[model samples]
Target: MRRFFAIGLLAIHLFNIAGYSLVFQYFIYQTDTNLITKLDLNQYRESELIQFKIPISVPYIADRPDYERVDGQVEIKGVLYTYVKRKIERDTIYLQCLPNRVTQRLSKARNAYTKHVNDLPQSKKNQTGSTIKKSGIFSEYDFKTLDYQFAAPLATASTYISYLSPSPVPGALEVPGKPPENRG
Candidate 1:
């Protein structure tokens, strides 16, 4: 009788552990973030980069998001220069594609980088200004990944890996000439 009781308890514990593991996996997700900053950017009054990580995390049981968005504002000398967001819809989103503006901007940066590198030796150019935003999906036979980037000249950047279930925040978009929020 005692042997049977021990085996029953062991079976129950195994089932409980497996149940907890599956529940944990259901709630977990990944947000792969990367930010690139320039080392000497502060020396240039006309240039600055500011970033924010907005929270969109929620429990899967409560709500699941089909669209994920990141919104942030860039301020230079306490003045808002631009507001940017990366909003992707799952059903309509192609696995790996750059947004129109991001593609154009990165292409422009590459062109500028090539020009500046060539011009520096021939002329007296001491500095080259470059910036880019690029994001896309990377796919292989085994897996697909979401990735993004921010770039500036003269330094390598930092990347952050997070597991945050996401949702979009309404009214997060800002346009040029619109009244700015008080960031003070």
Candidate 2:
């Protein structure tokens, strides 16, 4: 008798569980489903969009440095270089010339072009002008130059963002002295 009673109770529990499962499934099947619709692209217009502008003068980093161009005349080390009309005189005699040696005169493009003048007293960076002073069989010339350095400004990048977050629940953990993104 005890065995039969225990079996009857187990059957009742199984029946209840099966009936509850069927009811849950029926409720789930009877619920309404969300409808799928195609999006209407025409609703959004190009003019309604927000415009963000970045006004940085330098677009990208420069691989080669830039130098400040000194206009007019640059002066250094007690010498000044200025653009001026320069005249040079050339009158020479090769005392001991080799049979295979040759001499090239200055180009007439910048030449004084006068019968009495030969050396054009021009201030060029790397030019070694004719003898400033000649003594007997030796001569000495002068060169003008200035040491310049290249420089460029370093690029700087700064970024900022505005974020909006819904207000936190009435009672939530928050950082000290800091408010949520959207306060207004």
Candidate 3:
């Protein structure tokens, strides 16, 4: 009777463990599926944006102003030259890709870095600029993994301009300005 009772208890424990293991495995699978689904949704949004070009604004430093003062008489001050100064211009935003899971991660990281930079009271966000010059997708065979490469034009000075600007301005540039003159 004692031997039978011990064996029965062991059997019950084993069965319970097996059930828990199965449940845990199911839960993990579900979680992984959900993650993949979310990634897919992000990918879809990125694809949609690829069909249309978005504008990205970047800031650049302009030329600094200088002033000069001259004296006509040895004893009295004569003239003062005042310089005309202009503030830095705001950058144009060119959206290369929409916020997808992968790019979203990149964007978040960038935002965090920007925030940290801004926290430095001395740092200026308006003086910074960035431009996405080229981008493309590449896929790996084994996992069918797709990735993108973005090249941006950045300037430390607020007066700088993008090396390459996207052709056809977002909405304004669409209208034709003037027809080319006929050449004989």
TM-score of each: 0.15, 0.13, 0.18
Ranked by TM-score, top first:
3, 1, 2
Top-scoring candidate (lDDT)? 3
Per-residue CA lDDT of candidate 2, range 37-118, in tens?
1002222233432222223344443422222221122233433322111111232111111111010112121122321133
Residues 1-184, model 3: lDDT tens digits: 9999999999888655454444544654554455445544543343333221223354454422332221111111322111111122233211222222432343334445445533533234344454222121332233666899997877564785556557655334565678889999
Q: Which of candidates 2 and 3 reaches a greater TM-score?
A: 3
Off-target runs (Cα >4 Å) in candidate 1 are: 1-68, 71-98, 109-116, 119-184
Global lDDT of model 3: 0.39
Clashes (N, CA, C under 3 Å) per candidate:
0, 6, 17
Candidate 1 has a TM-score of 0.15
Q: Locate the minimum summed-lDDT window of 10 residues in model 3.
A: 67-76
Candidate 3 ranges beyond 4 A from true positions: 1-11, 43-184
lDDT for 18 in candidate 2 is 56
Q: lDDT of each model, Cα atoms only?
A: 0.38, 0.33, 0.39
Model 1 over residues 121-163: C-alpha lDDT tens digits? 3324444643332221332244659798976686866887765
